[model samples]
Target: MPHLVILYTPNLEAQADMGRLCRSLADTMLAQRDDGGAQVFPTGGTRVLAFAAAHYAVADDSDDHAFVYLNLRMAAGRADAVKKRIGDALTACAKVHFEPLLAQRHVGITLQIDEAPGQVYDGKIGNLHALFAAAR
Candidate 1:
């Protein structure tokens, strides 16, 4: 259960398309599997969400600069190499989404792969995966 959340400054809303970014991230995540295996992430559990920060201050506390932070969170228990590979793939996707704005202004893009506390993280998926495969 990976939740990809994108938080960006409000000023970038005019130039950024959150929906498209989410789609791009989802596609990239789906491409990577454990040891290059074929089992894909369940669509029902894969979440890509975005929130526009109403108030944010970048370096030097200037409003002229903007920032986009991505948090790729998943339940604990994975090899470090596997997690890093996934994180690296996602970072590239984030760069692709923010490059245009970055080229025009002082935009700082950061990405972090966080692991949810396994003890508290609970997840359950219905038959969405089966239905998706049937449609295909």
Candidate 2:
């Protein structure tokens, strides 16, 4: 089972990228929109229903190895395209560019996911939302 951690950009209006997903939970949530809880984006803009899409999780771990996985769902579907769009969004949010239009679309974001596990999960997985909610 993956331990999820939703993340957003500095603007909080745009969705998160792999870099943001790799951040700490506190850093991720701190990126949420100030006005309302949502995932912000640049080209994608602010998505109401789509706000919940930007997230990451601990995909697998053991005594010797572990990895954090960030997954972004996009209409584009192509991994390369998804990577590019997210990169552009991050750059815009980060002021990595001097171009006016590209830079202003940044927004804040929010994360909705599970807490760290106290014990390793080992049996058949159950209701994720319920499990995470209860843990929270």
Candidate 3:
């Protein structure tokens, strides 16, 4: 299970659709075959969401500068190599997601994959994946 979140500056909203961008990432991940990373993107388990930053500062404090951070959360167990592959894949999608803005404006893109503490993370997919998979 993995939850992908994108936190980007509001300025990018005019040029990008945050909602669709996040959905695209999820769809990409869902399409990939699992790389020893438990049941990769099992349907609804791959949740993609975005947050618009109302206030942010760049290194130069310039309005033209922007940033988008993608945080991937999943249960701890996967190997480092697998995580890197997953991250690289997602980051590639992210680049495409913001290509237009990156060309027109100064944009910084970063991605981090974090393992949720096993004890604290809890949830039920509730056959959502089955439903989503059925439609596919």
By lDDT, who's the top model here?
A: 1
Which of 1 and 3 is ahead in lDDT? 1
* Candidate 2: regions farther than 4 A off: 1-62, 77-136
* Candidate 3 C-alpha lDDT tens digits along 1-136: 7888889888788888888888789887777655644555567678898998878887785787888888888888666776777888888888887887777888888999889865664757488778877887
Candidate 2 minimal-lDDT segment of 10 residues? 41-50
Best by TM-score: 1
TM-score of 1: 0.85
Ranking by TM-score: 1, 3, 2
Candidate 1 Cα errors over 4 Å, as ranges: 121-130, 133-136
What is the lDDT for 111 in model 1? 90
Clashes of 1: 0
TM-score of each: 0.85, 0.20, 0.82
Residue-wise C-alpha lDDT for candidate 1, range 1-136, written one tens digit per residue: 7888889888888888888999999989888787758544666568889999877777896778888889988877777888888888998888887787778899888898888765664757578667877876
Q: Cα deviation in Å at residue 69, candidate 2?
A: 1.3
> Candidate 3: global Cα-lDDT?
0.80
